[model samples]
Target: MSDTPQSVSSHTALDQLRQLIQQQAAQQPLPGERELAERFAVGRREIRRALNVLEEEGRIWRKQGKGTFVGPAAPVQPLMLHDLPQRSNLLEVMEARIQLEPGLARLAALRASGEQIALMKRLLERMQLIALKDGDQHELWDSAFHRAIAEAAGNRLMLGLFDAVDAVRREPGWQHLRELARTADRLHSYDDHHRRLVEYIASRQPQEAATAMREHLLVLQQTLIEAINCGEEEQL
Candidate 1:
């Protein structure tokens, strides 16, 4: 069948979009449909059709609230961050970390560059220096340390999962529980754990790194549980 004029225009739009995508860096967000239509002198409908084809071809992906990005879609559907807190609890979030982070540490040991390892060390130091004075900043650096490990693991899908789990951990309720659990002594111990974990990764000891990560998370899990139980007892 001969291609109709509109269909021909759509095909042209697809080719233009592919070229545009190629010019973008991986994981970079594309301009919105309105902007792209203006740039290419095409209707929004044509741009949308072109984008859909690129998405189906594994050349682009979109997030809810975030715009379309220049990469193949994630292997699974992205987690719904807003709904996670109601559906999950502190213990469940810690358990999820226990399952995910050790493997990330192991991979970091195997795959992380010297620069990445160095950044982890710097972040650990920042956490220690701020731990006594600034709880919020300490938490921020602590999360950054873990995220550095996840990024060093060199697996985008697992990193996305780690981010989703991390988001749940950041909820105010969970943050409050973590703060309640963080005694000075416990903070010192966590610093030691972070040091050892970073050392293991720096030395490329995958098994030891994984073990250290698992043990650290286990301690955090136990501490949070203890704090929660104590809170409940006080309420009685």
Candidate 2:
């Protein structure tokens, strides 16, 4: 389906006003409220109501003499995990993550704002710091890193999906993979992929972002498969 339009009348009006601001940003500020009301087929009261909502939402700014303009939208709120699946299996987590993460990355590449990209950069730096401090806490940081990216995608629903997968972060196989994945060689490779994906997103290269995302997951999948196979061999 196409992206849902802003539904609440005030919200929709705010979005329309924002779009107008964007279009006219370099040229001139928008017309006065009376003109906007006429243009949108709404009364002046309705325009003022919409502007009030937009102001509260931080989607616009207004000066006493100058007139109203756009504001930076609010940063996305953190997602909470509740009513999600209670599984704690590593294979299940990895499989679900592989299914969901790449698409989110691709969308982020297409839709991410400057604020979101900055947040992602902060997360990457934090991940690097954690890796340096703890040496090989891949299970914790890797899962957090991915979830942070999903959240930065500005899609709360997908963040919740990733959270459900993350709930199994302490499973034995997950720990095993983290241990195996902690080596300097793998860490550099993994971090490289993460950086590349973030860069592609910042550059608004959806195809490259999607490719980087899939490649990152494939590495994890291959590692997990090899680990499972080796375990089976030992068992046999």
Candidate 3:
């Protein structure tokens, strides 16, 4: 049977909506259905249909009371170690990342979809551009790139743990240390690490991905330690 006009329109709307979602930051809320309908010049039914398709693909998630958001829904339970960040120092946070993130990269190599790999590429490019044009925003994009890999690993529990450690890394003192550690030479090295890590994941080489991530984190840890020691010496 020939496809109905409405069904065809809905399919087109679905493609449009997917592109729109790709342009948005992960975890960003989607506009309401009515707003989306207006924006896409489609009926509300068509908008709902497109949203349903996206939800099934894990591109968007809707909460009954809170509207829709980009990316897969997060685990409902918060991390139990709410006070851990306050008590932690930069070294501790690096320790946690070195332990956790390589596993994420390995899993991502094993599990990431083609679309997810493409997103990682886009994020890497964005991070590089930010490093050149807007140095301060580099950390923000860098975090997003790593979070994308963690999400692609398809482990909610591990992602929750990642978020916990990430929260600690975001503390003002930790951010300062990280900023201090990011000399131009180190930034260039980081860019190389990011490229190799993404390539390994894209090529489905789990061990290589894991090794690249571990090496990258170890370098970051060493640099941060140096930054902290330098700060102490200057104060003495």
Candidate 4:
């Protein structure tokens, strides 16, 4: 706890602070930086770094006029752009998503509220109908559905990660590939896949939910790559 984030090889202070916050009375604002620094036997810089980590992970949020407080387990907002320049790195974006989203699904399995699950179910049903209309609104809800799952995972950081990934997902090229990938059969499967993922979350099976999401993303990745290659072939 005496070390700065640079001096420390691990996030010990961050973990300690996170656990300490959990021990406090629910919904209570944590003490200011100076008090937490004194209590943890760490510098204020280390305490601030730990607080940033907690904030990103969705465990906490700070109000500008007020103090830091715990965020809702299921946040209402769907996205936050991380201010990164957009690039044509569609595969790389999908790679990052595969790495993060399954873990969120796992957390949702353990923590999702019934209301969150119900929202997901409604989104799934709507996506099926919207898919038939062939509109961008469906894709918007596609991102929303995933954001809802991330919120239900009960982690603030995952929501941020999903937000960054989703902002890139809105890029024109990626959107084109997504539309191309949605064949009649694949779109049908998409509904089914969404249903299965929600079912695992509803049933409270973490591993199963993770597996369901991982498999779904893998299929999506393959579809995107195939679409990209096909477009290249057509150009030649």
Candidate 5:
């Protein structure tokens, strides 16, 4: 179901250690996970995952609950990697957001400051208040909520990437589409999702936070796409 954290951790020791394992491992079995972890100066989790990667690639085999051994290499399983897209179209923007934000939320769950999470909670409260009263402040608070999550990620690059997408998201036409999609009828659901995202991040459950963020964006993406296809005068 939720596999985002493993994917997130795959980059660090997974790549370097994998290459080392492939190059060094030949006819002999490799060192146990503890030895590998000490040699690599990484956590057992990283070494374990690196071994899992090799096993998946058919470059290594694990004997039930025992040691891992080298095997003839097979076709590699392509690792999931990403870079921000240059396109600013709605579909492209949404796709980019989907790719980056969930991971960012995962990072935030691991690293977010208490103060930052509190700020996000305040922003969520503001949105609820705006929902109650007929007002234009909802958009501002919504934007703040996302930016807060980006800040909570504690990665400058992640923050910058989020800011870039958010800038495009503020474009008048994009704003209009979002307004159309995020209608009064669907606002409560949106609020609930946002609440869940904040709670997960605050609770420090990386996979749950990532999944929550992914689900939230997917709903937004679907709503926005439908609105774009239907035109402004139409209500969905």
Candidate 6:
């Protein structure tokens, strides 16, 4: 391996180096630090630092003894923002939840064991009980409920997607939608839907379970749209 060239400025050199390595790694395996330093006219230390930054950013991966490899291309994981700017735009998350979760629920219905179904049922009941109480502490239970559904699907990729997107679903504005509903009626209706969803899945009807989940998600979409609109109107 050739000697690595020294970079002039730390930040600029690192950024450029990261781009080059990433570009090259996409096409083929990357060379060692010493070679990279020589090609880029930088020092070995600078190449190492640049590679460190890339690794930190999830842009590359390295193996001890074996040379570093290019990281997997980032999947398109768009943030779901609520259209309403005044309310912090968690609608993007809601949109994603609507699109992905109903299918997950349907899958849960088909694939979940009786124990899984029971756990989901318990989560829904816990959420309902918390919703009935005061002080906005139900978000955790809410997340647990949805996460249980995703977990029941038993697909690693889907579960990872769910995990990646879960935080967005729990945004303050998203929680506030349930908190700010005009009456308990909507919340109660949601709880009822949750129970029915669990039952549909437990019954082992994939199509019906999927349909139920979609319908339930439709309610959620309507709720979010209304909340966003109301928030906008209040700002106006």
RMSD vs true structure, all candidates: 14.5, 15.2, 13.0, 13.3, 17.6, 14.3
* Candidate that would win on lDDT: 1
Candidate closer to the true structure by TM-score (higher is better), 1 or 3? 3
What pairs collide in candidate 4?
Answer: 56-157, 57-156, 57-157, 58-156, 58-157
Tens digit of per-residue lDDT, candidate 1, span 1-236: 11134443454465467667767778999999999888877778778867765664457999989999998433333333768988999899999999999999999999999877887888888888877675644565677688778878989899879878876776654544675787778889999999999999999999999999999999999999998998788789
Query: Global lDDT of each model?
Result: 0.78, 0.62, 0.77, 0.72, 0.68, 0.63
The sequence of per-residue lDDT tens digits that candidate 2 reaches over residues 2-99 is 11111123333443565565454333455799998778765665577567544543457788899876666333322324333343445666777778
Q: lDDT for model 5, please.
A: 0.68
Give the Å error, residue 71, model 3. 6.2
Runs in model 5 deviating more than 4 A are 1-87, 132-135, 232-236
Off by over 4 Å in 6: 1-88, 173-178
lDDT of 6: 0.63
Can you give the lDDT of residue 191 in candidate 6?
Answer: 81
| Higher-ranked by TM-score: 1 or 4 | 1
The numbered model that scores best in TM-score is: 3
lDDT of 3 by residue, 1-236 (tens): 11234443564466467667767888899999999889888788878866754664467988899999999544323244647767878898899899999999999999999988987888788777666453434555576678778988989899878866775676644545665787667778998999998899999999999999999999999998898998888889
TM-score of each: 0.67, 0.57, 0.69, 0.65, 0.60, 0.58
Error of 3 at 78 (Å): 6.0
lDDT string for model 4 (106-207, tens) is 999999998889878877876887775634435545666787788889888677678667766655434455656767688788778899999999999999
